[model samples]
Target: MNSPADSGAHRPTPVAVVTGSDSGIGRATAVRLAADGMDIGITWHTDEDGARRTAEEVRAHGRRAAVRHMDLTELPDAADAVDRLAQELGRIDVLVNNAGTGTATPFLDMEYATVRGVLDVDLIGPFLCGQLAARRMIRQGGGGRIVNVTSVHEHQPRVGAAPYCAAKGGLGLLTQVMALELAEHGITVNAVAPGEIATPMTGQEDEDVTSTSRPGVPLGRPGDAREVASVIAFLASEDASYVTGASWVVDGGMLRMGPQAGSHLESDAWRRP
Candidate 1:
């Protein structure tokens, strides 16, 4: 009849809640953090199997793994998921707000519901989860880490991605504000804006990282999910304690190609929706 805390073979380890972790950058980040000696709380929206696999991978690294269902469009539910994870794991040390959605419909043709869906999932959902995690961290008496997974579009824009660009832009600014307010509480808020990565979201599932090329990107290839995850791991680590309110771009200089230097090819190509 031992207490749960004393029953564990090992002492407590930090825990991280990674949303949309059934695949893509979420899964990669979860695994990487586990390798960094942190237990993982894996969340999935639609892919239960993927989430289970991610949890298994985390456990494979000799860390605790808990799976939770999360859908960002349901903000209240999302917050509940966070609370459950933290409670189950004893505490939440990090939260990666990676669940999001985008749209390609023309703005004029978009319905109110469509736009609202994107905003709810991308912007409002992260805000809710961030608030919940921050509150928990404050209660726990130690610092915590929150990494928002934005996109390169956070600073730029594309034609068909009006809703997405708007949400990411809003989240980017929100990240700064959260950092400013949460600093005194020992919670560091930051963002990771990724470029084109070879993942299911990019229609490049199962693509080999060693054999991919993207000519438009200066690096001449798509980024691997692990590459982005590495950056996230760094931001969540104690090493980044002094860093906050920052957006670390993992794009291979894609944003730098913006409009080019002098070739002003001003066509309506930007509105390709």
Candidate 2:
């Protein structure tokens, strides 16, 4: 890992807090930030070992790492977790709201409790986290970064995912609102919308995308979690200082299909589960 970024004599070494970083895109993002010279604060929902492993990887990358367990659905005050993490790490330079959940049942088949669960995890949780992080950044007297890990469904509808799509869509707009409100304080807020990434979330943890052939995807392949991390790393860097409130779609052109995707359907295949 690269050495910490030099912020001159008076500035503190940058630190980052990444939620849901036990595995997949979250883990890649934590590692990437650490390699880019930032101490890391990691949180996991149910994966204790995974979170520890992520923390170790950050330390291995020559950056300090702190681990905590955060279950958005169960937390009475989600921001409290952020506060503890920031306090433990001395300061927070960036916040990545990557933890989320989804229900695969059709909209009509979904229960109110299940829908609420998804909303709490994906939308409300990030909202609270972002607010806390912004407050800390304001108090610190320097700009910080907040990157919400929304999904491609934020822009499009999916048959089996109602709450997930709604939550992500809400987050996309929330990101813009945050950017507008936090700009004066020098805090930038943005959303990263990823398509099918080869992560544990997508059950592609053991698959190699390089050798796989996917004719359905425009890129003819699934995305690597690291690819999404690289973009997140850019947003966290000094290079993206002028960029804010934008949704960066790292879907390899999958999003290009919208109203046109239906025109090519051969039969009732799309109606199936």
Candidate 3:
């Protein structure tokens, strides 16, 4: 068994496969990891151009990069995607399951297909990808890291976001379970639950939702994708070897907000002018 502490051991250049790397937090995390000395495998759903841009950013950091086109909605195909990444990029030592979709429909209006689509991409997709990455890591005789990009909603419910909330909640627990099951193999699994981040998906481009006045959330402004990326990169690094089965909330203390009746006002340095 290869030990993580062995300094003389030949450390293969780390390879990280980040799904949904075409934009947003995934793309940022991929580039950040590359800058931290890891080669990157970037996966995209519809934006080949965006993935290529991310690849370019990685290369700018003097790290190897490969881009793959993958649709996370095809949950069963994730295994093949991971296999292809390992074969092409050399081997995957880190997996970031960041591909997901969100819907704002009320529960009563949510079609079965809508619910399934959310679960397939956010929950099942991560499970499949994690399994594939873990198997390859074990075979390579070294431990690896898996980071699931969940949301602050993973612990709290919101109006008109039933399916998204459910999927993310399930993902949070799945992260813990994966950690437990893969611990023997020396793999660590964790989650980064980000609050509102300035991204295309969150409608921040069209409107501002970062108001600190938004009750409950202490952070006055929306988080930057790079901020979330920083946490994900840390989790994927060797420094996080002992941290597993945990969900790091990078939500600017948003999840701690209670209802108006129970509200406790708090100030955020990130919010202070």
Candidate 4:
């Protein structure tokens, strides 16, 4: 927890706060950033052990790692973890709003609480955390990076994920607005839209993405977590300094298959939840 301010002669290292680092894309992003020479602030909601494992990976890269519990469903309060991480890690150079939740229930059957919960975690939570990180970056007088993890659903819709799509779509636009407003401060904001990655959320944890067949997808397989992480890492790096207000799609041509998929569908199976 020692900050550079605590040691007069020590220089501050870049630090990144990645929410939901318990596993999957978040974990991969945390480790990737660490490999790029950044201290990491790792957060989890239900999987503390997984978060600890991610922290170990960061430490393995010879970087400091701070662990915190972040329940995005708790709203504005949960965002306080961002500030706490920034404080513990000295400063926040990057913030990856990777923590998110989704639902597969049909829209007509969805409950108000379920819809609200999805919005809270996938949208409002990142909104608050982004504010916290941006303010800290402004106060610290340096440019920063903010990467919101959206899904391909952010740009397209599915049969059963009504609230999930709504939240992610809203987040996609939010990222653009944030980028526009934070530009003067030299802070860049962007969104990474992933599709069918081999993550726990998709029920394919630790599976070899290449072995998994995704017939509808042009790549013929789901993407690897590391593939998504690599794009995020680039966005968080100086190479992306000129890039902001953009949604980088890392779906291995999935998004491009929309027309092809629609034309080839033979039954009403595509309409079911």
The model with the greatest TM-score is 2
lDDT of each: 0.85, 0.86, 0.82, 0.90
Better of 1 and 2 by lDDT: 2
Summing lDDT over every window of 10 consecutive residues in candidate 2, give the lowest-scoring window.
259-268
C-alpha RMSD of each candidate structure in angstroms: 5.8, 4.1, 4.3, 4.9
For candidate 3, report its TM-score. Answer: 0.88
After best superposition, candidate 4 residue 139: deviation in angstroms? 0.3
- Candidate 2 lDDT score at position 24: 94
In candidate 2, which residue pairs get closer than 3 Å at backbone N, Cα or C atoms, i.e. clash?
A: none
Q: In candidate 2, what are the lDDT values of residues 106-151, reduced to their tens digit? A: 8889999999999999999999998888888888877889999998
Worst 10 residues of 1 by lDDT: 259-268
- What does candidate 1 score on TM? 0.90
After TM-score superposition, what is the CA distance of residue 227 in candidate 2 from its true location, in Å? 0.1
How far does residue 173 in candidate 1 sit from its true spot (Å)? 0.4
Q: Write the per-residue lDDT of candidate 1 for residues 31-149, one digit (tens) a residue.
A: 99988888889889899999999998999998899998888777677668988999999888899999878887887898888898899989999999898889988987777899999
Instruction: Show where candidate 4 strays beyond 4 Å.
Output: 1-11, 259-273
TM-scores, each model vs. reference: 0.90, 0.92, 0.88, 0.92
Candidate order by TM-score, highest to lowest? 2, 4, 1, 3
lDDT of 1 at 93: 83
- Candidate 3 C-alpha error for residue 103, in Å: 0.5
